[model samples]
Target: MIAEALITLSKPKVKISPFMKVSNSSNFQVSEFILKGLPGIYSWQHWLSPPLALLYLSSLGANLLILLTIQQEPSLHQPMYQFLGILSIVDMGLATTIVPKILAIFWFDAKAISLPECFSQIFAIHYFLAMESGIFLCMAFDRYVAICHPLHYPTIVTDSSVFKATVFMVLRNGLGVMPVPVLAAQRDYCSSNEIEHCLCSNLGVTSLACDDRRVNKICQLVIAWTLLGGDLCLIILSYALIIKSVLRMNSTKAATKALSTCSSHLILILFFYTSIVVLSVTHQAGRKFPLIPVLFNLLHNVIPPALNPIVYALRTKELRLGSLKLLRVHKEYR
Candidate 1:
């Protein structure tokens, strides 16, 4: 009897209920994501750190200088410079959103990020890119008016107008990109918790999910075409009109002068769009080689920010002279 009692006591008791059942299905949600940094080139990650660190520092320092220059010089507080200031801020945001995390992964081997933070990074990436596109469109419009309608340019792009345009750009981009993170956050990631890219891009993270991510992909494409595509179209149209105005000028010198004013802006726009196109083509055609696209994506984020100040601020005569004067003043004070 003692032996039987001991056996009964040792037996596991099962709680059987209609509501509680064994689950064969997997849990398709994740609390954290492991960032797989450049899958095949783990050894080269440390090597990549030096150049990337240089770029991050250059972007931050250059953008900050431009911002401060504009703030100190009252004469430089025009519509075009104001837009460029906003662009600088956007570039800083773009660099900050990606570089620090990338550096941490490279230098410290810090790969894991919580889901909420990952989503926040993705949101910032998309938001800043959208803002850049919109600001480019505004700059194109500014150039068009300054060249095409010189008399009305000042009145048309007044301080109030610039303020309103800035607000619209922020609101439009912020609202338009709101759905991207939402869709991405709803994804089920049972198969993997590893994003195969350097940064938390929308498609990169969504591709890691186990469930159907068609909706997420579709939303991404829709937002891209809507924001980027629309901005490109408007910019092209503004340039077309500006070119038309320049051609109508009787003297070749006058026409050249008109086009010269737009040269810096055109150069910046060319760099911006060329990188974007290369990134797209790499994503589509270079799928067999993933690192190409990843490198381009990283460069695209950093290079433009690093070059913007050089192209827009330092290249312009007013800004260059003002920077020199400001430096002289600072030296005298010191």
Candidate 2:
């Protein structure tokens, strides 16, 4: 009798009702995610592949040309061109990280991305963005030194300083943004596996988590503001100082020439930062129009890289001449 009672006690005590349903929550952990590209336009989404592919190719070609031109020309080996080279590399990386996967989803209907791969994409995209912001800051400082303290420019902005700045850029962004992907990846994604964005953004991924994602969102905001926001503020200050120095010049011709040097940089900065600001505002406002923001995000990645080399080549006489010379030399060799 005692043995029988022990056996009954060893078995789990349970109460079953006719209305009770077995829970399937244990099996709901997502293994992969589906990228729903361009919400509300699934039928005609393939049409976007052609123009986007063209933009990607143009971005790659233009950045490559700039890098090659900078590498070949000894006279263009100043700190300014060195920073341009770095920017071209960063732009290529930033464009390449997202555009190919987007094209694949559009053309081939391969929207399934493994969980690990998705997180990796998140990390890469954010890292490249932070690096680009850092490079822009460096460029702005270079301009300030060139304009405001012309005599000290040679000593202050040397090849050694550029190298140090590059090191700092890599370390700062790499270490800074590492936690974004980690925080997203650690979440329990049991609710949904469908991401409604073209790329694996941190917010999109974290929002699908079954648990609280307030910490993830907060971490992302903190890092973004610390890196991108900090860089932007410093860049603005540098430009402000540059403007003040230019105003102090007595000669109108001298002032015009100084301001002319910064015009291209200003234009590029506006293009880059304006899109980011608009995207952020739209996201925070909880706007109903999703497609516009998605398209703007896609265009923001490709358009700047495609235009950067062109802008510099057009505005700066030296780059234009170098590009022409490089093209001519290649043609003659062929």
Candidate 3:
């Protein structure tokens, strides 16, 4: 349903490398293929805003509830909950960065973002991605402590350790994700810039190139696997240790309860990573399967942030009760 003028601009005769060739007709010799422009993808973003706004509102409310409950309930103010607080803060950033923009696209017919706005989106998304990955790594270590050293959980995961871990996570993600923006800025875009999906993703940015993109693609692949993959392996190791520790326990009920406590965490991590991996590898190494990567990114990165709290908090008893207590307290004061 594209206009003929836009279609004409969509394909320029350039000499793109074979890897970049999605569909090469004898007539269309693109040096570098221009991906679709950014105008239409978010054109109806205003319509998309309401649902995303609701999601952010809900996540914000739930996180606030969790944060307040953790502060008020003496029993909940442990190192684990402290990390949960940190997670909430990071999740807030993650949601804040994306949801409002998405909402803007939905609520208004105009969906154009300036270059700076686009860059900001890229930075925020990568920053949050790094934070989320770093936090999960921290969370794994937290679980390792709780399960493996029940007697020494308090002494081990102390305030200082937790604080240091938080700082480290932020710094690591910041430094680690810093390269992407620098690399992305080097690429040139002419007419084609519209990404098929919402959000400013590296893949989307790289696709708009009319120059060599192999360097970007390789950097992306390396960073993606290195960060996310490392986190996943560490988590797996932590759980392996956790399972060993759980089996060592004499009481079956207690063991079951402990595992159950982490079930939500386990499930959420699986969903997050699985989507991430699929999204990473699915980008059209070939031109024909273009929409697959788009769908993958949209589903995994966008959808899971909203679903995270639902899986983590709503179903977990401590979080559920904590929410109730906060709500009840607010009702009483009113």
What's the distance in Å from true for residue 195, model 1? Answer: 1.8
Candidate 2 matches the true fold with a TM-score of 0.91
User: Tens digits of per-residue lDDT for model 2 on 1-334?
Assistant: 9999999799875453222222356544577889999877988999989988999998899899999999999999998899999999999998999999999999889999987789889999889888988988999999999999999999999999999999999999999999998888777776578987789988888888877899998998899899999999999999989889988999999999988888888888888888889878777643587777677777777788888888999999899899999999999999
lDDT of 3 by residue, 1-334 (tens): 4698899888756544322333432343223222232233433434545665777788787677677888888888778778777877778888887767655555543356655566667778888877888787887888888878879887988999999988887787788777776676666654465655556777676677666888877886787778877888899999999999899999999899889878878887887787776665776432566556665655555566667666767767887787787788889999
lDDT of 1 by residue, 17-112 (tens): 221222337633466788878857977887999998998898898788788888899988999889989999999999999999999999998999
Native-vs-model 2 lDDT?
0.87
Q: Mark the regions of model 2 whose C-alpha exceeds 4 Å error after superposition.
A: 1-25, 285-287
Pairs of residues clashing in candidate 1: none
TM-score head-to-head 1 vs 2, winner: 2
From the highest TM-score down, the ranking of the candidates is 2, 1, 3
Give the C-alpha lDDT of model 1: 0.84
Model 1: C-alpha RMSD to truth?
A: 5.8
* TM-score against truth, every candidate: 0.90, 0.91, 0.81
Top lDDT: which candidate number? 2
